[model samples]
Target: MTVLKNCRLLPSLTEGYDQPTGDIIIEGKHIQRICPPGTAPTDSGTTIDVKGATVLPGFFDLHAHLMFANQDYNASVLRSQNEYMLDSMEYARVYLKHGYTTIRDCGNDFYVGVSIKNAIERGIIQGARIITSGKIISPIAKGNKSFGTLYEEVDRPEDMMRVCRNEVVHGVDFIKYMITGAVLNESGEPGEMVTTPAEIQAIVEAADSLHTYVAAHCHGTEGIKQAIIHGVRTIEHASYLDDECIELLVKHGCRSSLVPTLSIAFSLFNHFFEGTILPEFMEKAKDACEHVIEGMKMADAAGITIGWGTDFDRENFEKYVGLEFTSRAKTGLPNEAILRQATINSAKIVGLEEKLGTVKCGKYADLAVVDGKPDEDLTVMKKLPLYVLKEGVLVAGTALQQEKSYE
Candidate 1:
């Protein structure tokens, strides 16, 4: 048990935290209660004085690839299996240190995500809670095989179910399937819909049988409707959305979250604009920015929940993961709305709102104490958290914790 005294709560993250400063009572791994400062008995556990700090729920990144070591697509095949697995283990610590206590790894090479998830659970490592999918499920295509075991290619539409179930057998939390081609693929259509409705249904059925869900990787409007209708739980990178696409998403009640990865698109375009990237990738990035921003506004206007995720390389994780928040602000959303997109809204998208998102009683005591009011100043997000707590325990931070033990 731990008592975080003099804590400040963000209104959006907590339901009834009316006080200017309160004490969070954490027993075991859950938040037992929140009370007025110095009101709770102090002779029960360790108490930390945090009077001026702002307490917010730990951030969530719903779309991530823990094993992507290469930011450059063409040269990605250079790394080995062992290298990816080892680097991923180290990257988990990075996520926790940066105040992201929970992350849904969108895809991975073969089994790294699952292996690392289990390792964390078994106490073999100290890291963020990892929700994982197996190798990416894609149709048979030349470019799909370029990333080694990162992709599990389906030879025919009928094979989709088997591929999805195979991932379940390997102990995945859910399935990640691709419905459209990507800009980085060496030999494939970037925006074309590759799978039929039947294929989508088959994958959905397989995930449903396991009592899980499917996350569809989509960058265009062609298959977003079918994927949502067929029950893809989350839509990754719906970069190019049309009126019909937005309509269908709302018509379906927006049950599926639209995770527009702005960091990757802006990163690519910025590098190209600065003459760092090759000529071939310039046009695609430019075209992606125009459509992605437009789609984001349309979704926001329609009241659709926009899940947050940053799609970037492993080596550049620290440098670019924080960019997603600022990039989201550039889309015209206020700082409060942008912060919600990363916290409560994201937890709702993954169906774990009851346990993970807020600083309420009975929820996990995963939290970050920042130096300023995030809702007023968005750039504060880019800075390291002063202190991070996971499951009622101090895990990582730079400041000295002046903890007092009660006898």
Candidate 2:
């Protein structure tokens, strides 16, 4: 047993430990008890003072591309079985450092996610719990090529089903389908809806049979409706959503994982004059930003469930969690609501509601130790966690003198 002493247990947005001080007792991989401070459960074998830090459930990234980064360069490609193992080890660690103990790897190279999940379960990697969707199944098009093309195409109902079912048979936790074209299409216009509703229906049927879920990559209203109507659990980017589409989403009890890929837009704007970006690219970026901004406002007004997701990494990877969280916090909503979006709501999106997202008895011991009170200032989320615990294991320690850094 392990005891996290003197911590403020923030269970969720509307729920928290009533007592001012308490100890989080961990037995094996689950939280066994939450007792008052100074009262260590008799079976406790390890003790660590949280120093009055706020202890909350570990964050979850509902939308993530594990292998898209490698598409830019083959130096770090993990398509090979051996390379996949080595690369996943590092990927898992980076995700854990950000206090995300659970992640849904939407897409990856060479089924890296499948391999990584296996390794993590077998005690090979030290990182977050992974829910990966093998390679994204897209339409057959130029964008489908891995290297020269920016997208991976997989059109045609037969092929889409074949590949999607193959992923399921391969033991993917979930299935991802690209219903619409991406924002970065070389033509500058959002790619046209590729798969038909019938096609999506096929994959959805397959996922349903396996008792899993489908996460659709949709930026257009048509594709969004198709995904929702076909029973996809979540929509990746509802940038083109309209009132009708929003209502459909609400009606079907589906949620959206807004990547707010502001970094992508910012990147385009930053490099507009470099001639490396196309005029159409700039236009698409502008359209995405405007549409997403308006869409978010509408969704918020409609009380639609919104989960925070930033498709940012490396060069523009804003490591400061607060910086990312602030984007939603400033949306004229309460900070606690934003926190819940990041924690509880996100967990619900990925089908992990029962296991994680909130601090409670019998849940995985994944948690984050933050410096300041998040209730007062959501920006403190930008502060690097004081300590991070994954499944009852202390993976990081507070370095008081170190400055909080963004990824």
lDDT of 2: 0.68
Q: Encode model 1's per-residue lDDT on 252-276: one tens digit a residue.
A: 8877788888777887767723443
Report lDDT (Cα) of residue 230, candidate 1.
88
Strongest candidate by lDDT: 1
Pairs that clash in candidate 2: 138-154, 139-154, 139-155, 140-155, 143-151, 144-152, 144-153, 319-406, 319-407, 322-382
lDDT scores in order:
0.80, 0.68
**Candidate 2: tens digits of C-alpha lDDT, residues 19-91:** 7568888988888888788887645387777779888788877776554433234443325556555655676
Q: Measured by TM-score, how close is model 1 to the native structure?
A: 0.93
Top TM-score model: 1
Q: What TM-score quantifies how close candidate 2 is to the native fold?
A: 0.85
